[model samples]
Target: MRTATSIDVVDHDRRRLLRGALAITVAGAAGLLPAYPGVAAGGDAIRPFRVNVPEEDLAELRRRVLATRWPDRETVNDQSQGIPLAKIKPLIAYWGTGYDWRKAEAKLNALPQFMTEIDGVDIHFIHVRSKHPDALPVIITHGWPGSVFENLKVIGPLTDPTAHGGHAEDAFDVIIPSMPGYGFSGKPTDTGWGPDRIARAWAELMKRLGYTRYVAQGGDWGSPVSSAMARLAPAGLLGIHINLPAIVPPEIAAVLAVGGPAPAGLSEKERATFDAFIAAAKMGNRTYAAMMGSRPQTIGYAITDSPAGLAAWMLGHPGFTHWTYDSSDPEKSPDEVLDDVTLYWLTNSAVSSARLYWEYDGGRSPAFAAGEKTAEISLPVAITVFPGESYRAPETWARRAYRNLMYFHEVDKGGHFAAWEQPELFSTELRAAFKPLRAAK
Candidate 1:
């Protein structure tokens, strides 16, 4: 275990006593939360935002984590049962005692963060413009169990490519937005905030940002939102790049749905991918998706109330568990994992974020479904298959699924959270993936 780092603490006992008075005033009998300070009173105003988690909230989070009741270790030593108790215990201990949410908060505030209203929800985003001339504008989205924190590492490299072993031409004006119900973004008080709606809001967001031509990228939930934007084919959207592309043929998907063998005529890579998907399904790897899609509110109760429970639940994600969690590996550090889990805890967005699964037609949407048609997407599409991803998307299927396939390459590293796990490699892939689209710009 890595030695715990200390944080400089200022006594906020007085502020804690007056915390209720600092709460935003309710607008009316409907009890609407007040608009953030500096946000204009009217429509389409993009206001600067900063992360300032209350010190008391952090204190209470640590208290909850330390107060957690122990669950007996799983009968098996492996992770087949779930995140093993031994693995989570140390991580939770660090989260309670060693982790500093202020560091993560400071990292976020170091960047250019902003909030804007889109489709009745206040969306939080990080907007960074490259110094290079004619830098291509690209909107990137984060997935479940992740917040904008996932993309933090790649921002500097992508936005300023020259300094990161790439040409100025590779520079990108990056737009990373927190999904409607995730991070600092306002949670939806009603239904209808699915990927399609989120996609439209992203398009509007780019237009409002004055980017007449832009591209998009995503993995996990971001995949569907970006794909939806492709389907929308909004005028400014030049193309899209997805690390997690849904390219399985309907025939193959149907067979897998029933736990059948791989269909015939698949290439070795395709067959391997097919087998992997079948194996994952049998292993109950997607049980989390099923639970969140069906009854997010039910499980939300436990995760929302218990900080340790929340950390364990989020760490159960295949992306986090599969990563090398050694303290020496900065990219896959446990602190980084806790950063994401802590964000969910601080914002009380466990239920709101899970609801995105519910909104995806109980997880039957094309994003989660393997065999959905990709013909509706008239715009150019690019894909990068990371070796550690849940399922390797075969080139054959990718070409077939994306009619106007512009780029497809398999990289040696990274996984479902490719950008988070391998930011430099992920940034390089983006530079190459969107190179062709740059000509259009």
Candidate 2:
């Protein structure tokens, strides 16, 4: 969910190549490929949805990948420059030749997917109702560079706990929705689809689905959405859980914002966390966020055109920096990584997804503002700190942020994409985190 900065140097030749390749593909495919309706015409109806990309589109994607004008290797040996070409080349090569979009598409189609109009945009979600009679409903949100695919691994574990090392009482009815302008969700044509609005739409979506009560969960951008839901205190909403708790205190945030040293009163752990943030900032790891938050459309053009470019662009995410890209690790597998990149490529959501950063208003948005702003959220709040997250949020900051902190625990594993990286552990944390709320439900 955390984005690293874009490539610092703009290769005008690469840009020209990307545009030319895309234009050719679009022109050639026009009037030849059959158009399939992604969302229903107009209605609040929750219409069934399926994945059916035209063969021509896949062919075009391959062509673009093969035609990609890759940039020279980074001047430096390490990732300090950007995603090393050596690391991404083979992956892009495999993506064009061996990677199967159909397999990823099939994985999505296997789920019970649907779309419904929420506010003006059609929201796509995978709704899996647990067989357990007393199952608690929880809506999980995915962050940038992620889709419902990131949560796919945790669905079975959460919704069918009895089959996945948990008791039936721990079962949940899971709702994984694509944020507006991400994945299968319809992109907003106008502004105002920020987290606060998206939070309201989620509440409406949950209500429309007949869930009088539900809990919300999110990480990355989802963190803010879940926070907004908590702040709204919408009727029938039980409580909320977040992996990326916005617990940075305003004083600390202000100091960090100005590149100042940690204040004197910090504990060892808090000081370490503060130092991590400062280090990340110093390394230009946050420049991607700054670019997306300010000029998404400017960078969107390059990613939207070249599939290889898009793949490389997404790989720049800080979440993947420490990930071991092996087939054995389902969470960090190359195929899974490609699945996420291809979704953005196929959906042309690069720009739309980036806009969420722009709308974030540098974390000043009411829903996004953390630390002191969290005091406004009186509802019960639970948090699980993954060891590999951008920074381990100290319990002190969490308590200071949430007025009614109900649960806080740190896991031994997992990173930014917690559920995707460790679905079993992630599900266990959720079951435990929401157990108290289930009683209230």
Candidate 3:
């Protein structure tokens, strides 16, 4: 779920050719769920939204799946070509016959969810409060191909910060919001509202909840959003902690970037780190990011409606991401990955979610840098890198912007979805990283 980096997940030219048709789908409307009033300034504090992703939407997906105009598969290797027909057909059968959206909806309803407008969009987030009187307000952000479901496991550790051997001062009032064009939030009709816009809106949201100051944390897309929150210096944003840092060395931009030459002007540590990141990304979790960046909506039909299609689309994930798939250390089961993807489908938010990538890739998102900024943050920033994530900037590069850097952690077990895969370790690092701020307060 940690997604600041969006590298090509496939061999470039082949991926490029696949976008011709799918690119068109990104522009058109796919999931037209009810839009809450964009201009509402004073609605009820908590507008109840259980996951009743309408039956009309479900029917639409089913119809499309049955009528799916099958694509011809490239021979042999599944790597070069797009999702294979051999895999997709059976998955469709399962989605229609076996996948259960109502059950998922019931589970979501069990959490405390509320919607409030910030910057003309209806922000849907789960605002979970602890029994503890004083809980630190912590907002969780998800990246593309992900939703609020990323941190569903960490809810326990985050809410009950004390029981997890952390201080009562560390207890968090958790807020997990659906990003723009992703889940319940409005698919931005215009371009300007990107991650920074989302971050600013989030800051406003915390203030609306009556907190003068609070902490921010996220991985993947959430990482940048949280970074933007710190960068914006919004009221009460105490400190920001993230899973990954999208690094761009301005001085030697050519040498270290993805397609750049071998890194030059580097210390041994920096060189080793850079090489490791490049190597991992090439070997692990590359395709999904490539497809999303190129033409997210190209295959929207599969993800949005066919439950089986959705599962097959991300079937390699939990194992590819969590250690369990290969058993290195930290891992999660297939059920967990299925649950996250299914949430999007059951709620019929798949295409809308993919649209975020289209808009972001289209240069519409704010948090994603134009080229990469001069690591301009002054507040304390902490980064936790996981195994499946493939890359973690070395301290030398990471320190360029985070001048007041407090912690740099690298764990071996988990992959991209840290909170889901290793909540205990993740929560531990979070409490420790923010300890200075919590102590000050």
Winning model by TM-score: 1
After the best TM-score superposition of candidate 2, give how far the Cα of residue 210 lies from its true spot, in angstroms: 0.1
Error of 3 at 29 (Å): 33
| lDDT tens per residue, model 3, 1-441 | 322232232112222322221221322322422233222345524354445555655565566556665556758664434445665565455555555555656667788666666665567788777778767778889875567766777888878976777767777778888887665555454555656788898887777767776789988778778887877878778888887675545544444344445555778866765576455445544556556556766777656555556655665442333223221332343344445665565445566565555545552322122232425666778877676664555666666657767888877766667786778788888877877776544
TM values, all candidates: 0.90, 0.89, 0.76
lDDT of 1 by residue, 366-417 (tens): 5333433478888999999999988898898888788999999998988888
| Local accuracy of candidate 2 as per-residue lDDT tens digits, 139-238 | 9999988889999999999989989999999999999999998887877767787878999999988887878879999998888899889998888899
lDDT of every model, 2 decimals: 0.82, 0.82, 0.62
Candidates sorted on lDDT, descending: 1, 2, 3
**What lDDT is obtained when candidate 3 is compared to the true structure?**
0.62
Q: Clashing pairs in model 2?
A: 5-288
- Which parts of model 2 have CA positions greater than 4 angstroms off? 1-42, 362-372
Question: What's the count of clashing pairs in each model shown?
Answer: 0, 1, 10
